[model samples]
Target: MMSKSTPLAALAFALSATTALAGDPVTYQLDWLPGGDKAPIYVCVDQGFCADAGLDVTIASGRGSSDAISRLAAGSSDIGMADIGALMAAKAQEGVGVTSVLSVFNKGPHAFYTVKDSGFDSVADVKGKKIATSPFTSSNVYLPLVLQDVGLTEADLELTKADAGALGPMLMTGQVDGIVAWMTDLSRYTGQGKDAGKEIIALPWSAAGLELYSAALNANDAFLAERPEVAARFVAAFKKSIEFCQTNPEEAAQSVVNMVPELEHGDVLGSLNDMLGLVFNDVTEEDGLGVFEPGRLAATWTRVAAAQGLDESAHGAEDFVTRSFQPGGEG
Candidate 1:
């Protein structure tokens, strides 16, 4: 056996293995087509945050939370961009192992829309009236908790599931009376000329005792266990990306537009600027962006549990969220 060559041969083999481990690729599924709400993530990619984190991150459009969760739990996806509600739902239905790392949109963007002249002034006014919503959201789940605070309950209203993206027009036309969804950017739907003069009455989750997190960076348990250092890097870079977006809104908006051409005309900046007012909020500005609040997560889970018509007990509660990656994060 050649003497001097032996040492060098071993070193080359070791380096190859090290590089392979370091270069492990990871893919993340976005909850919808990329756009303003997903701006920071696209900005992160454009600005090389993921690369700096030693991750080759891929963002793709998602069918919905259930699909996103299914892929993530099945290991078809290494990471997912989803809301706490999705995570809670998957845990409730299948006992899947998923965890949320960073929250992109700190404020829950769900709300109900009623015609300005409907005479439905408050939550109580919704009583005995038809209200439309998607059962998949925290808004549907926590209606009771919030209505309780507003002096209303499930018995007070007739609930219905309005097809997604069809609610805005349905509300503006007075077909269903009221529609529940994001306090949609009026500019978004009206820009399409479908719902001109349509107004959305904003009922922020914070005010309604539904302070659960929305739009978080998530991954499954196995991925986290196998590569924690990699996970930490991703979390850190994502946090840095948020700071960059806040400091440079124009650049951030453009980055997201590039990721989704349809959003170029969606009034990204104006809408994001408004959503930012609701999302950046006081807690985010003070505690780094994307940081999770356990109390809020718990509150959201409670509503989700009530919505599914079952109360969770025992160890599975950990399935909702985890703080292991947050404490040392840049946030």
Candidate 2:
């Protein structure tokens, strides 16, 4: 007694389901507010790379890695971009079911910036100087290690907690002797200094022996387990976007500005070029972009374990990272 229309309705429903399944929905979270440093990701979305890969992508800005990781664990986002060190800390403390698939910034960007007139020629000179830093920044998290390496201690400097945005203006106005932030911020701060006719000097934490991995692409474990092909497509699309950014710097910056029109185009371009060195290096030159070298990752884990007070054997390097998704991504 079934009506003939029943079969037609069932066929229409099946076709709609197939269309929905064709493009998996993905929500991506960022480690911090949108900026030129995040151009590759914006490029991927604006250029329809993710859509072409059969992903319906939604991008969200993060306060920091802690916030991003928490969101991913809570199922708020399927994937995230965050600091690898922050990811390590989360995995060590809470055993969050999120792991990074691609390492974007091989070189850490933690550093201190001071006007040349501050006479802070090296990390040694930072002692007794007033420093402004946001507790959220990766620079502050590794400040102890950098201090230890430079033969100083937190007690040696006068630290002031401030908003990340306020730190730059504070430094430019001589409100603080130095500002602690990432090297990507260095160019922007330097540009701020130039506007005021003051030269800014960068004393990198790397110089103080606090090298570690920075930003990366991370996914919720369940998402990877259930829809790995979708995740792999995302990785592949992102890889292409990073390559685009490397070759077409101005266009990449413009793509980001296209998404975030509030940002100054020139500043975005300048900052994008400034941070390029951190993203592309010998490791990237040998193994393709977004691929991490085993040795370097091991070294980074040592720093992460020490920073988080986790035992090395308990949290070996492999426990937190994977290369299976990278496939032929190696250069």
Candidate 3:
């Protein structure tokens, strides 16, 4: 028998099916393992920002910026976070098919961490001191430029490469006068220093004239060409996620922990709080969130070229980035 309620039920089922199929699938690649620095993407998924934007996002972990870029270049990831400097270098060297769409960390994160009372008050104070760094960190390439900025050179200090996990222990035990690390590790190193009965001090390269962009949102060229609307929606949603993290840090931290249950909530919160400064600061205040200011973009390419020994004239800064995906942009 045909009943009136059967038609209503069929209509409701059709609407539900339509709503379920509305979300576009997206693969998000990470430049590094899941952590507080990588919270915005997690927030986007966990806090419904991606869902609200009609995206079904899946995050893929990466070993580093280069790996993340490689995935994007190969079209394995639709969008991801990576160091824009790495992208600039890659574009000049190989013409990788990835374009940075938005700035994440507008300032460089390179810094020197020293135990307080070590007489290393500033970048200049590291002269003739022993510095330990990870062999594979991109910071190594920029070390020469940072040293030159402080009126010093590689010859002025003794440099040693060590495993990344050992850097803090080396500094606490006085094995090295300082360790070359990112500002994102400030809290971790500070806690290590306290346990060793010492205080930690960070000398950021940005404070000493390393005016350049760092981490940024990058998208695959093919993805942007084929699904322009999806790319734009993802970028807008990502910007919203960043804003949400800035306002509700604890909630943001929980979002990451919720997705990556192996990560402790406290550690994620601390790392996220430590990373906020790198994301939102003087540069971000001048240029609104997610913008790649032309002057800073040029400055970033200059620094990258100098660090990687690439010819500056090979490509313009615009070659590595596309602004059309941003809110109010041509897309």
CA lDDT, every prediction?
0.70, 0.85, 0.92
Residue-wise C-alpha lDDT for candidate 3, range 247-306, written one tens digit per residue: 999999999999999999888888898889998998888887878888999999999999
- The lDDT leader among the candidates is 3
lDDT of 3 at 90: 84
Candidate 3 lDDT (Cα, 0 to 1): 0.92
Clashing residue pairs in candidate 1, if any? none
lDDT of 2: 0.85
- TM-score to native of every candidate shown: 0.80, 0.90, 0.94
What candidate 2 gets wrong by more than 4 Å, as runs, is: 1-22, 327-331
Which numbered prediction scores highest in TM-score against the true structure?
3
- Kindly report which residue pairs in candidate 2 clash with one another: 288-331
Please provide, for model 1 over 1-331, each residue's C-alpha lDDT reduced to its tens digit, 9 standing for 90 to 100.
Answer: 6799888999999999788755557777777666666676787787888877777777766876777777888887878787767787777777887777777777777666676657876655777888888766556766777777777778888888866777766676667767676642544544433446655565554665566677777887898889888777777777777777678888888887887777763477756665565457777876656666656666667666766666656324445666677756432
